[model samples]
Every structure is written in C-alpha cells, then in structure tokens.
Target: MHGPEIVTTLLEMADDGQTRPTPSDAWHLFLSGLRQRFRLPSGRPLAVIAAVLIASIVGGFGAAAGSWAAERTFADLPSQARVEALTRQASPGDDYSYDRSTSAWGTDTTMGALTVSDWDPASARDRFAADGWQVTTVRDMSAGALAYTNDPATGSMTPLPVRGSQFDAVRDGVFLRVTGYVSPGHGTVSVMLWPDDTAAMLPLMLAGAVLGLVAGWMLAAAGAYRMRPLPAGRRRVATVLTGLAVTALALPAFAFYVNMTRVLGPSGSFVNTVHSALNASPYWSYSTPRMLLLLTVTGAVLAGAAWATMGRRGRSTPAADQIPTTG
Candidate 1:
C-alpha cells in the first residue's frame, strides 16, 4: 500500500478503537510513565514492584488465617448457663474478677477468678460433680495438670501432659484451676474459657481476604513509590514527608478496614460480640492509645530528619549540578 493509504488505514483503526490497549498494555504504559516521571532505574524499580506484589499476596493470606482463627475461637465459647453454673458454685463470699489476654491471632483467653476463704480442692470437685458437671482430678498435684470435657453424656476427666512452671487446665471450652496460699488461708479458683467454632468464620474470612489483598497492594505500591530515589532537593524532602504522613495514616486505615470486614448477622454474630467485648477491655483501650502515640512520634521524627537532610543536601549541591528536566 502507498504511504498515505497506510497512514489513513491506521488512523481509521485507531478511531474505531480496533487498536485500543488492553488492561495489561495500559498497566505497562502506566509503569513506563512512572519510571520516566521519577527517573527510576529499570532494574531496581522492577525489583521493588515485585517485592510489593509479594508483600500484598502474603498479607492477604495472613489476614485470611487471622480471620478464620478469630471466628473459630469465638464459636468454641461455653454456653452462658455453664459459665453461670460455675460462678454460682463458688463459695458464698467469693470475690470474682475477669482477667484476659490475647497472645496470638485467633487466640483469646479469659480467666475468671474467684477468691474464697476456707478453700477445699475436693469440695470444689464435689460441687462440680453434684451440679452434673464433669470433674477431672490430677493425680500428680505437684505437676498440676488437668483436662476434662463438660459434655454430660461423653465427657470424662483426663490427665494433661505436665509442662513447665505454668499451671494450666484446659478442656473443651473451659479451663479450671484452684491455687491456695498456706499463710493467707485463702484460695483462688480460676476458670479459663476459649469458645471457638470452625464454621463460623467462612464469610468474614472470605471478605477480609479479598479486601486485605486490595488494600495491601495499594499500600505496598504507595510505600514503594515513596522509597523511590529523587533528585536531592525539595522533591526528596516532599517524598519523605509524604511517606511519613502515609505511615501515620495507616493505623486508622487498618482499623477502618477491620471494621468493614467484621462478621455480621446470626451466623457470625458471636464473633462480633466477642470482638466487641475484647475491645472494651482495658488492654485494648490502653494499647490503641499507646500505638497511636508511637506512630505519631515516629512519623514526626522521620519527617524532621528528612527535612534536615534534604536542606543540608540542597545547600551543598550547586544549582548548575541539579538534574535538568527532560522534554
């Protein structure tokens, strides 16, 4: 074909959208534009991009695992009747308090302790048995191990593998322990509970996995961009400051995302209730404030350092040595 005819055909194809770029093509074009705009080296940018992608994928799976565990833990909790029964079995003047701590994802433990006078271990065991509750006695009292199931029909007392200094008794959804001090003439009876059901977390896990992947990818990309090399001047200072700002903002963003992905309705309602209960506890209330304070201080320090470093660099570099803009 003649040159003019060939050109006219290409123009027609373009106008008709026959040659429009695919999503993949557009993504490549966008990356190219970014590389040119930031003067990023080809190899390093690719490596950084890959790292961000990997981080997002890993983060997504982590979120999924966490959500699943949380749901399962929430489902395994004992019935209110069982808790009430145990509490009522305590001595007449027993003082009760709740103690809880979360050590890992999907693992929440609450220990209810009752302090009683004239305590008797055998009496407590008998009390539980009288109430139709399964009672487990540890033969090696020194070792202090206990495991029992509350299932009325099939539950039985069993010996737990004795571990280190920690005194623990866990069975089904409740763990019980009675510790006495010879001098004080008083004993503390503690009931530890972990309620979990495997099926309860499916929907929330699915949603959190999806949303976490998207958010992780976005946050990763922003992080990589912030770390990109810049010509030493106001631009570098600005990038660093922006990064610090983004880092500071991430805490709230994470909290908001968690709230959005929370389980709802009858199916996973227990999980939501458990989360609410935990959040109201002192540990959560204090930890959140401390975390925010740490982030704020860290961000401010980093921003200040970036500003100082950039100002010093700017003063040392001659105007003539500054990078020239490309057309």
Candidate 2:
C-alpha cells in the first residue's frame, strides 16, 4: 500500500484505539503472553502436586523402614555392654580417663595394672575377698597386680571393698557381667552402650526423613522454576546435576554429623570424647531417613517436571495453540 494509504489506515485504527502495536508495545505484549502460556494447566498441576504429597507420605514410611533396617544390620555389630550407672558428669575435682584401646569391662590390661592410681591394688583385692566374694580367677599381668574374673556359678554376692560407698550408693547397686571389646582408656566405663534396641530410634529417623521431604519439595520446585525447559537429553542432565547438588549439601544440614565424627569416631564412643565439637544444635525428629525420602522423592518429582516442561525444543504444544499464529 502507498504511504498515504497506510498513514490513513493507521489514523483510523488509532481513533478507535485498535492500531497495530509498536515494537515497545509488542515487547510488553509478548511478556504478558508468556505469563498466560506458562500458567500451569489446571488439573495437571494438581496432579503433580498430588504426586508430591504421595511422595512425602512414602518418604515418612521409607524412613521408618530404613531405621528398621539399620537397627537390624548394626544390632550384632561388635558392641559394649554396660550396666553401671553414670555416677556424674565429668566428675568434679577428679581427673580420670581410660584409654579406649587399652581398657575393657571383663578383661584387665597391663596398662591399667601399671598405672594404678588413686587406690592400692593389694588393698582393693583384699577388701573384695573379705566381702564374702570367692575370687574365681585372678590373672597376674605383672607383679603386685591382679584382675579377677568372676563366674556366675557363684551366688549373687553383696559388695567389694574396691567398689567403695560411691559405687554401692546407687539404688541399682547390683553388679553386672558385661562382654565387649577393650578400648585404650574406656575400660569398664565405655562398655555400656551396646545392644540398645535400634527400633527405639526408628521414630526419630523417620521424622528426619519427613523433614527431608519438605526440603526436597522446596528445592525441586525452586530448581524446576529456575531452569528453562530444555531438550530431552539436556533436561536429564539438569535433573541429575540438581539432584547431586541437593545431595552434596545434605551434610551441612546437621551439626551433629560434624560433632559425631569429632567425638564418636568410626564406631562411636561411650564417653564424652567429643566435648569440644558438641553444640546445642536442633535436630529434626526423623531427620535422617526423612531427609533421604525428601531428596530422592523431590529429585524424582523434579526430574518428571523437567521432562514435562522440556519437550522437543523446536516442536509445538497443544497448549500454545490458543496464541495467534503468524506467517
């Protein structure tokens, strides 16, 4: 059309407020158009949301299952059996430490015999005998020292001199027979944490798992929204990377893991070996397995969402049909 024809047409369309928009108007219209297009599908987004809810439920259940499994798996693991009550925390004005590798509940070591502190061995043994306790077996690791191993064949006796009033003062003053590995300084004190029912701790693990699920959902939602839907292969890569990132950050979520390692070591310790690292950290009720449930489920859900949003890049979608087609 000629310049005048076009100008006249523009003026007429403008008078009625129906003119073809300029480039700046077009840019705004395009942005607005995208908002309308990406508005999640009605029933579809709900289905996705429902799927996430199901995932959370599964997560909670899964945590309980994992706890059950760990309980069973680690039950027969080399353990310490302690029947002694905690006399006090870090005993006031007294410094006593047993080397975990060198000490044991039932077995006496040369290290202990050599470092006889605070009491006389001859007197302790003599006192024990006077209390009507028949000494079953005494092994002399060296001179002037003896470790007596009592047998159950003997009747439940009263008390020994070495035990002192402090040991005998407790209401639960019955002596116990314990069996476990001997660590250096832990001695009789470290052998007590064994054979605790793992199932008792399951509920706590499951709670952590539940919390993990919520965190997973948020992470997945945020990541899925941030990533521009890509081609199929790229989408998979993105999801995997996102899942890994989530997994890597998991350790920082708890100060306990740090503290646990500092104090507990490979198998963990019965004593307060890790006092320095301990902190007043809030722990999730079922944090452990719950977090696993969250991360896995969330990552999986995000993967699916990423897949749905990232169809063939060059392809068209039915949802996009409502937009005006241009030649």
lDDT of 2 by residue, 1-327 (tens): 123443444454463566576777668757865554334334447435633643454344334333334444333312121211121120111233332231111111111111222332344334434554332232232233223444578855433223211111111222211121212222221112223233334344445467546554554444444344455677567656545533433332333233323322443212221111112222244444245435446655655655454443343332332333459
Task: Give stretches of model 1 more than 4 Å off.
Answer: 1-41, 45-65, 72-85, 88-117, 129-135, 139-185, 194-238, 245-289, 292-327
Q: What tens digits encode model 1's per-residue C-alpha lDDT throughout 97-166?
A: 7656553123455556666544455665666667565555732343444433345566765433322111
What are the RMSD figures for all models against the true structure? 13.9, 17.6
Q: Which regions of candidate 2 deviate over 4 angstroms?
A: 1-146, 149-212, 231-233, 245-327
User: What does the lDDT come to for candidate 1?
Assistant: 0.47
lDDT of each: 0.47, 0.35
- For each candidate in turn, the TM-score is 0.40, 0.24
